[model samples]
Target: MHLILTGATGLVGSGVLHAMLTTPTVSKISILSRRPVPMAEGHAKAHVIIHKDYTNYPSELMQQLRDADGCVWAQGISQNKVGKELKRNREYIEITHTYPLLFARALAASTAPKPVTFIYVSGEGATTSPGRFTPIFGVTKGRTETDLLALSKEAGSNLRAISLRPGGVDPTHHKEIAGFYPQRTGIEGIGGLILPVLRTVYSAMVSPTRDLGRVLTELAMGDGAPLSGRGVEGEGRTVTNVGMRRLAGL
Candidate 1:
């Protein structure tokens, strides 16, 4: 199946990329990256499109997304900017608001079938209720979730949208971007003792990169066409690492 993915360079997105690549069912994986991403040779159908601006997407590729089988949208930055950082808040709003909405619109305007899905990566701390807090990370996430869900609901013709609210993706491979987040688990024995608990929880509540990718791959691979429709509104899903591996039979 042909798939499209964003944030190909971030920790979560990189893990998702690895998971999709290892899965045999995925034929082509297209990435919307700000810069060209480096991947190994013979990786399962990979395409890297260098597009710095996610807000202003190319019209031609918007049409091409119609033929895509699925999308794993892992874009957006993690933030904890508070107080004197109101500008940062504005930037967050711009990214979450314009980028996801525009991309979803582009995909919808493409061809029929709506490409089956467009999985959005969100945060676990987001509240189902509406309220804004200082350093409003959750507020941004909650708003994004609401907007995307609305977009999906209105998108007829078999379009589906799902949000993954992972607590913190423990990258077993990449280590550089770990410092980007305040809650990040970096190497050098910083968050060392936490790995075991993370490992166990990942096996249950969290969806590991490999497992989440497999689930998405399975859906994209046409494993269960009917089952893929169960989104947050339809069935509500929040994958932990443990649950991810178990579902993938790892």
Candidate 2:
């Protein structure tokens, strides 16, 4: 199956890209990124699109995406960078909320076959409800989840939207990217110890990033049961960390 992947350079997305590259089931992978993605060298099936703007899509780009079977949206930013970063609020909202919604609409309008899957990478604590007390990250992500689910249920739409909420991702199996990992610090060092302890205890609060990637690839490839049996309409569902673990065979 051919698949379009956003944020292919990020931690979780990079893992997904790696897993898909080695999987025999997936024939082609189109990575949409601001810069050329590393580790895609010598892979004939890997197609890298160095897109500078996420806010807009040219007709030609849309045409390329329309031919794909599915998309995995792993683009997002941490809430901690709201004001400290340059216009990060807008950037976060654009990447996390607006871009996915727009892409979903375009894909839905496309002539691709029915039941096209769109997997969105959300967070563990995201809520469907937004309020004044809600953090900007949660508010934006929650709204995106809600809207995507609604879109899935729309008549004549062939999109099946699924949200994955993973927590405390363990990046041991991931390749080292220059700016992906945080600089070593006291708290970061402590997390190193804590992650191993949690894994030893089989804590469900954390998930291996590699496993998360595998689960997403399985879903995109339709490796399991049908998403729904309710007529010909598409479906929407959310998978938490535990569900992701089960899907990952962890």
Candidate 3:
């Protein structure tokens, strides 16, 4: 199947791209990005579309997207950059919602609105409840989730939608991105080391970034399950070294 995706440059997205390339059923992939992703030694049919602005992406590109079976939306800025970065959390939400909506609309307008599922990547603690305080991000993600669900309902049986919410991603990186903050550091790092212990003692749960990616890809290729309002649970999901070990076995 031909798949369209966003945010291939980011840490989480890059992992998603890696896993997707090996999926036997997924032959063609169109990654929406501002810049191209440099592929590893071998990957087949990974198309990078450099569309500068989703808001103003040409109709030709939209047509190209509609031709694809579905999309994996992994776009948006991080919450840590709220005060420091040029674009804040709210803008992040807008872009996230807008990009996916464009894909959904394009799919609906097509003559064959086949079983094209949209797998949206939200964040941990994205509230279903209104008026929660979560560093402005709660507001942004909450609204974005609401919008995606609404889009699915509006389409009725025409579109299938699913949401993934993963927390504290630890991308396998050699060097930290100069100024960017790592998700788990010092105390958080210490926490990761002893997390499996805590899990055994207190019955805790977490996930590895790779496992999260695997789980997401699994969800995208839905297993005869009907679409519901449920977002895939990844709460308290820390990508610790042990989780990494567990994933290696899989």
Candidate 4:
């Protein structure tokens, strides 16, 4: 299967990319990033595309995407990374919501080799029904998932959209192969040190990067059947952390 991936430099995206590269079923991987992906360099199956704007997809780029069977969207940012609230909100919405939506729409409009599958790498806490204490990140991501599912419903068998919600993705655990696993620092590093304890306490809360990657790859390669008009927590569409672990045989 030929797949398109975004944010190949990030923690989650890198893991997904690694799985794609290693899997014999995946014939090609198109990586869209602002800069060159070091991990993709020298790999015959990896094609790195320097795309500056995610909101707009030029005809040339769309043509390339049209040939692909599916897309694994892992582009996103932490809320704490941005200093100002206004900028953070804007960046979060654009990166997490707008970019993937635009890409999906573009693919839906064009002809494809087959029904295109779009796998969104969402987080655990995302929800459409926001309480008084819900974070802005969750609210935006939830809305994005809702919109994507709605779009898929409209598109019928032409396009399929699915969201994978993983919590506390542990980057340390993966296949003993060449892959991009970033060095954790600060709070993330500390969390890595106690991952076993966290897993014991909250088994469903932590997802090993390898497991998450495998699940994403499987979905992209059409492991499960299409959605049966279910809601966001549908059988084939939305997968939680526990679902991911189960899919990966963890």
TM-score top scorer: 4
193, model 4: CA deviation in Å?
A: 4.9
**Weakest 10 consecutive residues, lDDT, candidate 3?**
230-239
For residue 96, model 1's alpha carbon misses the true position, in angstroms, by 3.0
Return whichever of 1 and 4 wins on lDDT: 4
Return the TM-score for candidate 4, rounded to 2 decimals.
0.89
Q: Work out how many backbone clashes candidate 2 has.
A: 0
As a whole number from 0 to 100, the lDDT of residue 64 in candidate 4 is: 80
**By TM-score: ranked, best first:** 4, 2, 1, 3
Report lDDT per candidate: 0.61, 0.75, 0.59, 0.80
Which tens-of-lDDT digit does each residue in 1-250 have in candidate 3? Answer: 7777787776667667766777888778888888767742245678888888776656677677676666667776655544445244346655656666776666656514566666777766666565634555666666666666666667354556666665555443313221222355555566557656644563223444455555556555553134332222323222222333343353
Query: How many pairs of residues in model 3 come into backbone collision?
Result: 0
Tell me which residue pairs clash in candidate 4.
none
Q: What would the per-residue lDDT of candidate 4 be over residues 1-250, giving only the tens digit for each residue?
A: 8898998898888888888989999999999999989888888999999999999998998888777888889998876555565644678788889999998888877744367888998888998687888887888888888888888778354678899898887875565433555666776677678888878898777888777887798788883355432223754578778777777777
| Candidate 2 lDDT, 67-150, residue by residue in tens | 777788887766554455634367778878999998888776773455678888887777786667877777778788889988
- TM for candidate 2 is 0.84
- C-alpha-based local distance difference test score of model 3: 0.59
Q: Higher-lDDT candidate among 3 and 4?
A: 4
lDDT of 1: 0.61
